[model samples]
Target chain A: MLKVLKYSFYDLSRSRWTYAYLLFFLLLTFGLLNFSHDLSKTIISLMNVVLILTPLIGTLFGALYYYNSKEFIDLLLALPLPRRSIFLGKYLGLSLSLSASFVIGILAPMLLFGILSTGLVLNLVILMSTGVLLTFIFTAIAFLVSIRFEHPIRGFGAAIFIWLFLAVIYDGILLLILIWFEHYPLDHFALLMTLFNPVDLSRVLIMLQLDISALMGYTGAVFRKFLGTSLGMSIAYATLLTWIIVPVFAFLWLARRKDF
Target chain B: MIVRDLYKSYRKHQVLKGVSLGLDPGRITAVLGPNGSGKTTLIKCMLGMVIGQQGEISANGKNIGHDYLYRKDIGYLPQIARFPENLKVRELVSMVKDLRNQPANYEELVSRFGLGPFMQKPLRNLSGGTRQKVNILLAFMFDSRYYILDEPTAGLDPLSLQRFKEMLLNEKQKGKAVLMTTHMVHLAEEMADEVVFLLEGKVYFHGGVQELKDTYDGMNLEAAIANILSLQEHA
Candidate 1:
């Protein structure tokens, strides 16, 4: 499994898109920091971008890699290795590489700007951790989508659809439900709903950490009130961890039963 | 190796239905069938790449169910030579060797197939015949007891094809069980000690080359298979 992970990481690290992704973050972080000259505001801006962009890139890259490496994967299947190791190795390799790019891209610019000396360092840590979590969550979901659908176009479409649903549509539907039930005591309901979507949970968690009530919105306020600061952060992280694990198990289950 | 009452289906389409056969060391068995006749499926089932719903497959008197270590004893050459395009031939070979953790002496096989010139070239840059040679080298590098080659002669030049046949015969002499699928009747007639003819997901005929020829009253193995198919169509 470690050998498989090493090779996969090596393979993905050399891909042009990985470098492009890293460069995009580097430019984004440097540009935002240079203009604003405020670490907190830059983190907020970066958080919004990270929450949306990470999932999109993760889903697209994961599905593309799975489909493209399919023939090679078939060859690997013929070898004397367990099926679970092959898939889990691939998942970890992809997640780690993407997380590395995100970490390096964001950290280089921030360190140059000396944000580490400020009180905002903890906030930056939360933001980076959330970014990494989003990458793993979406990549695992994309693996599940790719293995479930044999056709590349269908798999690609499904992955994008999932990202859109979680990153965009799910929030919209939750907002509609909140508006419809405005009269009821809905704080607990809202917090529970936020836990279901990793994107919303991450947004709320970071907003609470930043303690910016105006930007917290209703879901974030509910999260803060229901669980407080430290407890809310821990629970949100746990939810994100669950999000990563469930889809990975689903991917392995589907891969084991799938016909090569 | 023995297979008994193996059955497999994709959706509503059945590929293998109650197929059974045995493969022995020091002999080669050619799995012959028309298109979509479950030839590849059988090979995959034996390799445990595809799971058959109802069957028992045992290698050397041990059940293959829920076990993967037995695959180390089998060398498989897929029908298509698909590889990581970015990896050079040498790197891919070493990667597989590392994955299997087996000591392999591929230097002679590499030179025998004249693959030395293309060793540093990425797999995607090589021609089809060259890639097939790489596939053959990968399969033969490990000194395994069993081999499953699917369309091993595809895209090979006459010289390489001759070399490939000699290599298989050499392996046979060293007591390896080889199960291959091919459309080349001449290769089968020249090499196979037994023939398993599949039609509609079942074994329609299983015996030696001359026995198949005598039973069908045909001049050669090719004519015999053709006659069997035509007779089935007419019947």
Candidate 2:
């Protein structure tokens, strides 16, 4: 498994797309810092971009890599290795590389700005951790979709739709539900809905951490009431971790029984 | 190696129906069939690439479903030669070696296939024949008890084809079980001591080449196979 992971990582590290992704982060972080000149404000701006962009890239890159390497994977399946190792290795390799890019891309700019020496360091850590978690979650979902669909076009389309539904549509529907139930005490319903979507949960977590929950409207205020303490934060992080674990296990289950 | 009561289907279409055969060392058995007759599917099931719905395949006294380590005893050449385009030929070779953790002397196979010049080139840069040669080299590099070659003669020049035949003969001489599938009847005639003919996911015939010829009342191996298919059409 480690050997497979090593080769996958080596292969991805040399690809032009990895470098392009890294460069995009660098330019975005540097541009945001230069324009805002405020650490918290810059983090807020970065959060908005990270929430949407990371999942999009993760979904597309994951599916593309799986489809492109499929023949080679068939070759590997003939080798003296377990199917679980082959698949999990590729998933870990991709996740690590993407996480490395996110970390280095944002860290380099933050260090240059001396943000580490200020009270905003915790916020920076939360923001980066959220980005990493999103990468893992979306990439695993992509792998699950790719393994289930044999055709690249179908797999690609399904993955993109998942990202769209989670990142955008889920929020719109949640808004409608909130307005429709405006007559009742809906904090619990809003919290449960946020928990269902990682994107919304991440936004609430970050906003609460930045101590700007007052601007977050009704649901955000409710999230603050529930997640204002460290225990709530821990629960949110646990839920995010569940988001990563479920899809990955589902991918492995499907891959084990799949025919090449 | 033995495969017993093998059955496989893709959705509503059955590809292999109760294929049972025993493969022996020091012999080459050619699996022959028309398109969609399940030749490759049988080989894939044996290799455990495609799981059979109901069957048992055992290699060297161990059931394949028991563990994957048994795959080390079998070397396979796929029908298509596709690889990671970004990896150089040498790197790909070494990576396979690293994965299998087996000592392999690919140097001779490389030189025999005239792949010395392309060793440093990425796989995508090589021609189809060269890639096929590379595939041949990889399959032949490691010494194993069983060799499964699917369409092994595809895209090969006459000279390289000759070399491939010699390689198979050498393996047979060393007492290795070689199972191959091909449309090249002449190659099968020259190399296969026995042939298994498949039609509509069932074994239509399995015997020595001469036996197949005599049974079908044909002049040669190709005629015998054609006769069998034509007979099926009439029936």
Candidate 3:
């Protein structure tokens, strides 16, 4: 698996898209910092972009990489390596590269603005970790969709739709549900719905960490009441970790039975 | 290597039905059939690329269903030479060697195919024929005991084709088993010591080149195969 991972990382290291992704984050971070010297405000602004953009790029890049590497995967399948190794290696290689870009793209600008000397370093850390987690979760889901659907267009379309549903539509539907159940105590329902979507879960987690739950209205105050404790925070992180684990195992199972 | 009573299907369409054959060392067996006749399916089943719904494939007397290490002895050349874009030929070759963790001497094969100039070129930059040459080189680079090539000569020029044929013959002389599928019947006529004719998921004929010809009134290999297909269509 490590051997395959090394080669995969090497293969993707030259990808122009990865560099483009990194450069986009750099420019965004630098631009945001230039506009606001207030460190907390910049972190919150960066959080919004990371929540939407990381998952989007992860989905698109993951699907594109899988389709493009179909031939390479066939070649690897014929070799002595196990199917688990080839697939998981590719997934990790992609996720790690994207995570590296996200980290560097954010960190370079944060360091330049003298973030280390301030109290907001931990906030930036939380923001970057959320970005990395989103990368892994969305990439794994994209890989699963691509593996299940053989045609490139269908797989790419399905992946993009998933990102759309999770990042945008899921919130809209949640809003409708909240309005429909306006008379009842609905904090638990709202929390459960947030847990179902990694994107929303990440947003709540970041907003809570930034100490801006008051700005989130009633749902924010409810989120702070439930997720303010250390125990609740641990559970949220565990849920995010589960999001990464489930899709990875599902793809590995599919890869084993699939015919090249 | 032996494949016994193999059966495979995609959805409701059965591709291979109860096909059986054995590969002997130091001989070349050409798997021939019309389009969609399970030639590639059978090859994939044996290599465990496509799992058979019902069958047993054994390498050196061990069942290969749950074992991947058995593939270490077989070198496979797929139908098309698909490679990662932006990867140089030299890097691809080295990557395979690194993955296999075995001593491989690809220098001689590269020189024989005259791919020295394209060593530093990215795989996508090479023409189809050059890519095919690279595919052939990768399949023959390691000294494996068995070679399974699917359409091994698809896009080669005459000179590279000749070199490829010579290299295959050299491997056969070294007591390696070579199983290949090809549409070029004349090339099969020249190189195959035996032939396995698959017609509609079954082996219609499995015998020597001359025996197949003699059975069909001494016609050439291509016409003999065509005759089998025509007879099947009539029946």
Roughly what TM-score does model 3 have, to 2 decimal places?
0.97
Predictions in order: lDDT: 0.91, 0.91, 0.92
Cα displacement (Å) at residue B32, model 1: 1.0
Pairwise lDDT winner, candidates 1 and 3 = 3
How many Å off is the CA of B162 in candidate 3?
Answer: 2.9
Listed models, DockQ each: 0.82, 0.83, 0.82
RMSD, one per candidate, in order: 1.3, 1.3, 1.5
Off by over 4 Å in 1: A217-221
Query: In candidate 1 chain A, what residue range of length 10 has the lowest lDDT sum?
Result: A213-222
Candidate 3 residue lDDT tens string, B1-235: 9999999999999999999998999999999888899999898888888989998999999999857898889889989788876789999999999888778999999899999999999898999999998998888899899999999999888988888888899999999999999889998899999988888899988999999999989899889888877888898
Tens digits of per-residue lDDT for model 3, A110-153: 89999999999889888999999999999999999999999999
Model 3 chain B is weakest, by summed lDDT over 10 consecutive residues, at B224-233
Task: Give the CAPRI class of candidate 1.
Answer: high
* Candidate 3, DockQ score (0 to 1): 0.82
Tens digit of per-residue lDDT, candidate 2, span A68-88: 888668878999999989999
Q: How close to the true structure is residue A220 of candidate 2, measured as C-alpha lDDT?
A: 75
Tell me, by DockQ, which candidate is best: 2
The CAPRI classification for model 3 reads as: high
